[model samples]
Target chain A: MSDSIPDVKKVGALLLEIGGLLMSSGASSERIRITTNRIAEAFGYSCDLLITHRALMISVNSNNSNEFFSSLKRTSPHGVNFTVVSGISKMSWKIVEENWSIELIKEEMARLKSISAYPRWLTLVLVGLAGSAFCFLFGGAGLEMAVTFTATVAGLYVRQESHKLKFNPYLNVFFGSVTASMISGLLSKFDWGTNPETAFATSVLFLIPGVPLINSFTDLMDGNIMNGVIRGFNGLMIALAIALGMLVSLMIYQM
Target chain B: MEDAVLILEKGFWFAAAAIGFAALFNVPRRVLWVVGLLGALGGITKTLLITQHQSVIVASLAGSILIGILSVIAAHGKHAPPLIFSIPAVIPMVPGAYMYRMMLGFINLTATLNSENYAQLLYDTLHNALNAVFILMALALGVSAPMLVTRKESVKNLKLKRN
Candidate 1:
């Protein structure tokens, strides 16, 4: 281990980088605070972090001296990537155990950032299958599951395309639901399945904002009420967007 | 015997759904199967409890707590955090049907404020909304309780050992 402490400014920047990554990647507030603090402690410094929906502020103080540094970094828009969250957790442990230098930490962070998501086609198809599973679990028969599979795939495609076009996240959800429900609403119109309503309902199950809802509750439980409320409100807004989309489709089908 | 078979089938679909969502969330490939297993366990537990005539809220709570405990244990073996497994696993239990009904009734209520069935619509909407909210809270609290109890001490120990 290096006898001298790392420069406080660099450490503060690194800590802010870690905090921003975790915050944007759907981590609970507690996890962000803990993971960054763990990395800072490993470098013989103490970290205090103030996390909000829009930005992260971190202060790092050297244990050996009066040196201190603090900085703020604006987080990017939120997204879900469990791989990044877990990767950083593992990296923090390695930093403490292997005594990773800041350079090595930077390299590992770059590697993590570059990790590719699953292929777009694969994700869409599998998510479609998941929607079918939900339909079946909800008592939909084979034909209903098949219809749900189609609707979910189409809806997710629209969501992905809109997301790529830099549309608002909630707008993307609204578009996805509109597409999915419109497709399934046709099943009800044609009277093809034993329970067409089940298919219609479960088809949009793919867009339920599961991460934010779960994370909001965890944040609240950990006493981070401000972040918890923000996340909860975010989840509720996405859900409302979904409902409005479904309502439009329902009106079209006149159901 | 038939009931057991039905539960197994439900569990299978639940596992499949969980794995698909896990992939969408970009869960690490190494632990995808673990997520599937945890999902199946939670779903089967809820199904079994419901068969025994338990309320949906209680059953959901039991299932999510099981997932939470198992995820903590699984994290040790896989070298990943519990949330990666628990979040995707608990997702299959979301009260989608209730939420859908609530939203549908809400829309109808707004459109028919003076209709004869307005009171019925209002009651149904409130009922479904409350059920959905409670079940969601149960799932979240159950999955997070174990981690909240264990994480602080674990991190503290790591820091102490190093110092």
Candidate 2:
């Protein structure tokens, strides 16, 4: 597995970059550890990779080499991007199997990065449908579901726009939740459907802490207790933000 | 027959929701349908169990176990981690209503001036919140069970390969 010992600095940088990309894309710490290690081992080197909430570090040494290559990358706060994680997962294997040169791997990663999951309009449509699905599942009939579909489409648009503007994510959830809930509240107030109560609730389901909650538990199960606590705390804060928006809407409706 | 149809509808919508969220999360296009199917499976199982009068904890745990097993199989087939599927697949079962109800209950408990109803509201809030918490915990544990087991097996295989 040994060729001209790959340039340590270049390999270390790539490993850290992979770590940053995976973590920022919301891949869990454990997966980041295993994936980066595999990629390193495949490149005819051995490394220690540590992935945490704020940063990822990789250090590599060849048994016969005196100097070590190490790099640390800070992870950005990110929403889940499963496509990137899966792409890197698959690409790492391909690199091993094909014995891809570093330049080839770099070119592939850039190509993968350019592939958006869906166009903006499609994302909006699908998220709107998701909101409608939740409404229907919770007992909304056709009218309420339609209202939610529209409300959610608009709400998600606001969320996306705010995110692009670099608004804090929790604040985006708060504002987005309030706007969606208020409109749905108006629909329910007028007796628009068989289950008005459900319409009011499900529109905000889009903002629920589904991933963070599950990630926290999984992190804890994997003995990453600090990460578990961090994720759990972050999720609780988002939940509180959601609750705040809903409660505020409730107050407005009462008034 | 009507019951089966209603259950079928629930499953369909849950899968639809899964696809929606999966898209939002940017799941790899190649495997999106499998994730949707897994979500449907979990949703139908939970809905059926609830119809049978199973407690929320039991229903959620059972549902997530199905998701867990399916994700492990999918994890292997897809050559990716199980969480990539399980996370979005579990979204349809999130206790959003309970969370809202708990918050609403808190509002009432706080706004009231220590009246008899305040005690009731406090209890109600705590009860609903606890249900949300417990069901959530059940889901996480259930989904992780299969992943952890398979992960251990995979690790063993890797070590064997090294030798």
Candidate 3:
């Protein structure tokens, strides 16, 4: 496989696909660069990737000839799927060691993309539990945790439903936060918990943009400042949306 | 004895939170428990440091450093990217409450510009926002420090050795 050079166009498309998958799946910029470079090296080509928050570009040149190819892909909306990231990473290594063909890489990419996420109900329940845990960690009592749990589950459900309907990402966060805070606020109005404020504060914890916030910093540290700033700004906007939602709920409760 | 029990309890909640977030991120099932264990250890480390009178930001940095190192090792053994473990594990330390408060403060500041408490609101908002920002920076820096230092050798080498 190393002796025979693959088509530059095919290699370019493959590298772009790989880069696009990694980008949308929440891989850090450094990981995307390294993984694509590794695969290109395995195929006896030199590859360059320019990754951004919403798109990826790849340029490939052959070692044995003047063949050159460059292509760009607009990535799908960002989502966190560590399973895809890990699978692609492992596949890159396998491509190097096993000398997999371009068709094989495409097949593997399809398989990895098709891998099912955890069941919706399970994710809802567990994420709700996570919110309650945050309540406890923040010094909430049992009743507060219970309230936080209910609020979080409802919030996550609403968020998921809106996402399925293709709602704007910030609007989805606003909706989820409002739902969670409203639940906790109404419960607090009824005086059902020892510390209703804690429930109110922690119920929206599930909506925190952990991945983007962390990735932004990593990207900045790696000198991918453009992507870093975009991600960081995106995270901040989502956080503001969550806060606005909570403020709306608070005003409604006061009324 | 009481302190030990408190730390254990905290660790349990942290583990549950980490596992939940990890699942939400769709980390593979086989490594969910590994993420949980790492989350517990990292949370416990932070809690212990806080108990020792360290600031929250310092404790977070220390805990995240531990997570970074451990996740690198785990990534090798499990053949997964280190972020799979580190992101979820570090979630327990994210200052969600502070972030919320800061945002709330800003909202209130805007709505109460003529009020006497405006200065207090501005101060509190800045305080909370800065705290959140620094802790987040600490976490990112701490978690990436190991990988940054080992960049020359590369995580690829680590995986290669495992094979």
Candidate 4:
């Protein structure tokens, strides 16, 4: 529609970058496809996206001229960052609404990418607090709840440390669960909590694959069977890791 | 009165836990509390059904359905996609104790050498593991039912392209 020949290749590459980022950041395939298409069309190009569990491929055609350019990107599965998804979706909407030029769109994209997350300590504390709250919800009262809080806090710290040190993700989860259950298991022996068993059981609540499970389930129902099943299997493996770690601690304590 | 207090307390913790999970995953602060409240609603709904004698499976299904619907509405209201709210809302209902118990059962069953209780422990372990798996499946299906209707259609995806 625009008289200037839109650089279909550049636009396609940008769109592909965004898609891969969203995929790696844990967006469902549906969301990634829709958002990438929306952003591309706003700039006078038609986008076709093929999203898989490990990579994203995208091609765009300049309107009328029909000159097409494609990009292929290798993407690793990363942890969920919902705020990033939320922000990027909104940004796509704004791109079309304001009729922003390609330059403006690219700038906005980088800004979204660079946005800093909350402080590490804050995230650690909040997650610890959350795990402790779930422990209470599960009937751990008073001292049991307190131990759950402390155990989860320490466990999350270990998880973060492992992540920082670049440990394998599965190993990070296993070790985190091991640490959490170990704390709860060992402390419960000394009357530190009324429901030591409950603490040991509940601290691993933080490690549940709830997000992946939810996403994969939606993916399956939406007919993206491959991505859905892959993610579901991945979630199952995480659950198994959690179970194994908990069992290891239980076996040690024999409680 | 006692029942009401217990329900309220559970709701409170569920809300707190939801907020914590959201934070841990770095959900933005602007809509952070709203997601937590949605999780609380789900927790309260399921807790009420359980106390009223519903099966845990049925209660979880009902609760996740509630969460999925609320997440859809919240997404529109907050101008965000639904996953941001839905995923965290679903976390509070996870059956952690049963999962752990199932693992414990397996460890005990395998570690013991010629025990008469092996069959019973095997059964209990299988039952707990199945229960956990089934609850997770129920949660997924419940949420999926609502989310299917909310997919961004081709038209809506390009809604702002008119300019």
Candidate 5:
């Protein structure tokens, strides 16, 4: 609607780039589809949004895709809002169009979330079992309960807490895991409940950054170079956070 | 029966917790709850499936794909974004805990200078680390399967129209 003719192709390319970034950040296919739709609305176009893990591909009927991209490159701010980059290749576009949609994608995402250690109330039962096991391992009862209590509490809070304060989700998890781990270590020193491994495991289960890391590697394997690298870096940072948290705890306890 | 009721109550709360987290990740709250429920069901069924000698990876993958499709079912009616539900629902399956355990195992093994504990520590750590890697791979595959399938369906439809 702006007097300037919106370069539909470039806009499509931009959408793809944003899509790549979002996916790399661990957004699901559905999220990317909705985002692409929103972005298209922002740019004054009704595009058929085709999103995949590695790219956002749009089919625009308004103009030649290449020319539209050039005009978009010209009109965009010299720096900040969008980093000018090579447009998505036809092959890449085809791949994306082949793999993604705005259809029922929720079940998959939910299923993924269920694999965490603190997933169900059954997790509480598992925590109880773990506590008993820890008791058997360390020859002890009271300590594990405290650990379980603390871990469950931590798990509950981790869900409610804001990710905006997070430098990275992985870092948030690392700190959280460390907090749980330290509590376990201290409780163990007091000979409380089988050394609290169960509690620590239960609480820190929410902190694992496994999915993002795997996505990064898969994207790379799928030939999404930029997407893979960015996601892989994020995964690395998360893993590092966990490793660091554990290392620091170990050093402090002289374990 | 009482135990079953208790499990359902707790399951709903946990599912609610998962949905709440999914919402924070920017999924639409309503659709996410439904997907979360199905995912919980799939997750529960997964335990049975595995026990029944069904492949864990296939069951997990199918369960996730079902979650993905069911969430998208409302896309046309709501004009809603599918990711709003899908991404959050998938968060539980990400395998972050396994990686954490592996790291813990490695740390425990390395810090233990006692030779008697060394082999046991090393073996456990390696086994966990390997499991973490494989699960991570499965999670990725599970996430991507629906996307790939949809693309194929779309292409087929397009070709059908042309013919």
Candidate 6:
């Protein structure tokens, strides 16, 4: 019976290690929050920690917190591997184990992983396009504006997500505006099948509220001032981009 | 008469499209209808408010402030996305089409022989564009006023948190 107990313990530890690896690999901002929250609640512990490379490092400020440490040990396995990344040691498995749990932590993390899913980007695109189409129909634009506005905004939104770039707030605003200006200018020069107003509206649709103006306002209202300022700057850049595009088109017309 | 109605209908649908787009994006549905009404009203009233010989800036300011006041009441009531719900209504007042018209008119008049007579038309166009810009700025300021005032204390509070 004594011999069998050690073997059972080893196997259980192995399973927990593998699960932690999988959860950390899929970490997103929301998942990270839930994972950390679960760990704190499960162990009756509260600590500030960062998870990196599929491992968690928790900071505890009490001497008798060793009991809490053992709980983490049961939850986390892989025996607390440590590395000097982010100019901080004691920030990986070593901090968790030499300090906290291995098993319970893993179980809570698995829950977070189960709940995590990517946002549905396509649904947002269809919604925006539908709005643009409606605008084209009612606003004094011909068929040309509705079709183009829908296509452009949808395409921009889709392409942006696919790239997975650290979204530069100003770039999209400027680019969307410039692109709209170009299309509008081309349509105006040709005096095409539809009126100029339709063409202008269609091109500018993509440049609209996708910039998060209202959300920024809400953030400000909620007293998240920095976030509000950041989003506001982003919105301003977008408007400037539109103005730049208009300026360029004006210059071209003058020439 | 029929032509005018058709134009109005098209404008109505365009406004509806914007409202529909807002809905699809999960903007509060109650607010969307109000935004549509405000947009259409802004468009129609703007045309009526334009007198042949008037101060363009004054006209735009009055219109923008008027719309801004209405938007705040509606937005606060619905607890909707303020700028998203209000900005579109201002779209109908955007001077894009009018500015284009002015530029085109300038080009056509200049290209024609009666250059001196075309000055009045060119001046009118410039006035309209300037008025549009002024109005747009006012609209932006006015619509954002409620949020800005509410945010001041919150912003100050955030500074304390960051430190």
Which scores better on lDDT, 2 or 5? 2
Which of the numbered candidates is closest to the native, going by highest lDDT?
A: 1
Candidate 6: residue A100 lDDT (0-100): 35
Q: Which of candidates 4 and 5 reaches a greater lDDT?
A: 4
What are the per-residue Cα lDDT tens digits for candidate 1 across A1-255? 577677899989988998898888888898899899889999999999999987998888888899999788999998898888999999999999999989999999888887856888888888998999999989999999999999999999999899999999999999999999999999998888799899999999999999999999988888899999999999999999899889899899898
lDDT of 6: 0.46
Off by over 4 Å in 2: B151-163
Candidate 4 lDDT for residue B93: 89
Q: Say which docking band candidate 6 falls in.
A: incorrect
Candidate 5 segments whose C-alpha is farther than 4 A from its true place: A1-174, A214-225, B1-17, B53-59, B74-78, B94-97, B112-114, B152-163
Give me the TM-scores of chain B across the candidates.
0.92, 0.90, 0.93, 0.89, 0.70, 0.54
- Once superposed on the true structure, which residue ranges of model 4 sit more than 4 Å away at CA? A1-5, A190-192, B150-163
Q: What's the TM for model 1?
A: 0.96
Tens-digit lDDT track for model 4 on A1-255? 344745787788789888887887778888888888888888888888888988888878877785888778998657777777888888888888877677877787777666646787888787888888878877788777788888898888898799889988888899899999888887655656667778888988888888778779878877899999989988888888887787788678776
Query: lDDT per model, in order?
Result: 0.90, 0.83, 0.89, 0.81, 0.49, 0.46
* Model 5 docking category: incorrect
TM accuracy, model 2: 0.94
Winner of 1 and 5 under lDDT: 1
lDDT per residue as tens, model 3, B1-163:
9989999999999999999899889999899999999999999999999989999999999999999999999988888999999999999889877886887787787777678888888899999999999999999888888888887434657544537
The Cα error of candidate 2 at residue B122, in Å, is 1.7
Model 1 residue A216 CA deviation in Å: 0.8
The DockQ-derived docking category for candidate 3 is medium
- Model 2: per-residue Cα lDDT over A1-255, one tens digit each: 546757878888988888888877777778777878888888777889776788877888865668688777887887778888888988887877888888987887787677787888988888888899999888888988888888788788888888999999899988888888888888756766678988888888888777788888988988889988988998899889888887788889882
**Candidate 3 — which residues are off by over 4 angstroms?**
B159-163
